[model samples]
Target: MMKYLWLGLIFSMAAFRVMAFPAQGGCKLAQQHQITGKVGRAIHNAAQAHVVVRANMLEASLSNAVQAGVLSYQQGHKQWLEVHSVRQQALAYKQGITSHELKQFDHKLDRVTLYLCRH
Candidate 1:
């Protein structure tokens, strides 16, 4: 019984570390909810709220990924550059964020977190 229990535990831990492009299997369902929930809430919040939230998420996620060895510093930095660009554009908009801009922000962020699962 102990042997079987140990094996199950090992497998479960390995399952979460997987970094698959377009995440698949059971992990997808779990990550989709956490990431999507934030996106949903951001949509209803203030205009700057969505942009700020997602920009921070991208920076933090990429930074963590680099530290975890899931992504190299160069890879993480490249994405951070994009995040900076999005934030800058949003701030420059004298007018409140538009629907298309919001979608763009979400779309870019979705790409960044695509492979990440709760770690």
Candidate 2:
């Protein structure tokens, strides 16, 4: 009877361990998914920061252009507003945006950059 009770106790302990630990594959997959999510979020944040900083720098350049008479105040203000809009959009989206949309914003900035640098 004692031997049977001891055997049952050991069996129950083993069962408890199996239930607690779970299968390694499932656990590892969950961990991997979590890591992927974190990495994606980090990349997205970095992209937003990069775009916003670029917009700010471009705005500064526009200010300098206006002051130097390379561009008129009217034109500069318009472009400045555009840059602000782009920066705001970059800050707004939580998920990754399409490259086409990014290209459109970059192309607008590039147009201004080229005009400012050339003249």
Candidate 3:
């Protein structure tokens, strides 16, 4: 009975080690996800600021984030396109763009942020 108990303990420890190793990768991925979230939030806040200077600043920050690998090129490109599109629309309409449209773009950014962080 004692020998059987020892064997079981060894097997369990080995299994735990295997599981724990993958969890370290998971923890790293979680950290990446958090950084991406921060960048996404910054983008959202910049859009909400409704100032041209802030928007330009946002573009620069986004470029840096993408270059730093915080965001993928595809994700950054899509966000860039949306930001520019909204800017153009705001310019075309003196009254400015709608919150609903901005929210939609923000939602896309949020989704991409989560996706990138996970994979």
Please give, for residues 34-103, the per-residue lDDT of candidate 1 as tens digits.
Answer: 4422323324435556676657666776675676566778887887788888777766666557777777
- lDDT for position 40 in model 3: 33
TM-score, ranked from best to worst: 1, 2, 3
Worst 10 residues of 1 by lDDT: 20-29
| lDDT of candidates 1 onward, in order | 0.60, 0.60, 0.47
Q: Estimate each model's TM-score.
A: 0.58, 0.55, 0.38
What is the C-alpha local distance difference test score of candidate 2?
Answer: 0.60
What TM-score should be assigned to candidate 3?
Answer: 0.38
Cα misplacement distance, residue 28 of candidate 3 (Å): 25
Per-residue lDDT of 5 in model 2: 100
Q: Model 3 misses residue 27 by how many Å?
A: 22
Ranking by lDDT: 1, 2, 3
Q: How big is the positional error of residue 12 in model 3, measured in Å on the Cα after superposition?
A: 40
Best by TM-score: 1
| lDDT per residue as tens, model 3, 40-116 | 32234333334333334345545654665556788767766665664454344444445675555445444433443
